[model samples]
Target: MNEYQPQEQLQNATLILILGILSIIGCFCYGVLGIILAIVALILAQKATKTYAQNPEMYLGYQNVKIGKILAIIGLVISVIYMCLVIWLIVTFGMEALQDQELMQQRLEEMMGQ
Candidate 1:
C-alpha cells in the first residue's frame, strides 16, 4: 500500500494552483477553459487541506495548499465577473438593435408622407 506523503500532496496542490493562475491569464483568449481550470484548482486545494488534516505530522505543504486555494478563488471570481460583463454587454447591444429598428421604421414612414 502506498503511504500518504505530504510533499507529494503539496506539489500536486501547487501545480493545480499554477494551472489556475495560467487559466485566468488565458481567460482573455479562452474564457470557459479558464473557468474550468479555476474550479479544478479549487478542488485540488481542498483535497490538500483534507490530506493535511489526516496527517498532521506530515504537514509540510500547508502553506502551498493555502496559496493554491487563494489563487483558485481569485481566478474563479474573476472569471465569473468577466462572464457577467459579457452577458450584460450582449443584452445591451440587443436592446440597442431593437431601438434602432424602431427608429428606422418611423423615419421611413415620415419620409414617405413628406
Candidate 2:
C-alpha cells in the first residue's frame, strides 16, 4: 500500500494574484507602479509555471498563476499605452502647460484652431 502525500499550493500564486489586481489599479499612477507590479507578477508566474511543469501533481493553484499572468499582461499593455499618452502630452504641450489645467486647455484649443 502506498501512502498519499498532500499536494502543496504553488508558491507565489496568491501573491501573483494580488499583484495582478493591484497592477491594474496602479495604472492610474503614471503607469510606473503598474508596470512594476505587472512585471513582478509575470516573473513570479513564470517561475510558478516551471515549478508546476516539473511536477504537475505535486502542486495546486496553477489556475491562479494562469489568471494572474493574463491579468498582468492586460495591465502591462494598458500601462504602456497610458505611459505613452502621458509622454506624448508632455512632448506636445510643454511641462508648464501640464502644470496648469487652464493652460493645457488653452493649448488644446489653440491646436484645434478654436
Candidate 3:
C-alpha cells in the first residue's frame, strides 16, 4: 500500500496577503511606500499562483493570491493619482511654495475662493 502525505499550502501565500493589506495602509504615505509594497505583493502572488496552477493538488492559498492581486492593483492606481496630484501642485505653485505649509494652505484656500 502507498502512503499518503498532505500537500503544503503555497509558499508565501500568507505573506502575500499581509503585503496586500499593508499596501492599502501605506497609501497614506503619499502613495509611495504603498505602491512599492503593493508591487512586491503582486509579484509574489503571481509566482505562487502560477506554481499552484501547474499542479493544483500540490499547493493551496489561491484565495490569498487573488486578494493580493486586487489590492496591488488598487494601490497602484492610488499611487499614480497621488503622484499626479503632487506634480500638479508643484507646477501650479512652484516647489518653494509647496515647501511652506502655510503658503500651501493659503494658496489652496485662494484657489477654492474660501
Which lDDT tens digits does candidate 2 get at residues 23-46? 999988889989999999999999
Ten residues in sequence with the least summed lDDT for candidate 1: 89-98
Residues 44-68, candidate 1: write the lDDT tens digits.
8777778778866765767766776
For lDDT, candidate 1 versus 3, the one ahead is: 3
For each candidate, give its TM-score against the true structure: 0.65, 0.94, 0.81
State the TM-score for model 1: 0.65
Top candidate when judged by lDDT against the true structure: 2
Q: Give residue 77's error in model 3 in angstroms.
A: 0.8
Best by TM-score: 2
Error of 3 at 78 (Å): 0.9
By lDDT, the better pick of 2 and 3 is 2
lDDT (C-alpha, whole model) for all candidates: 0.69, 0.94, 0.85
The parts of candidate 1 lying over 4 Å away from their true place are 1-11, 94-114
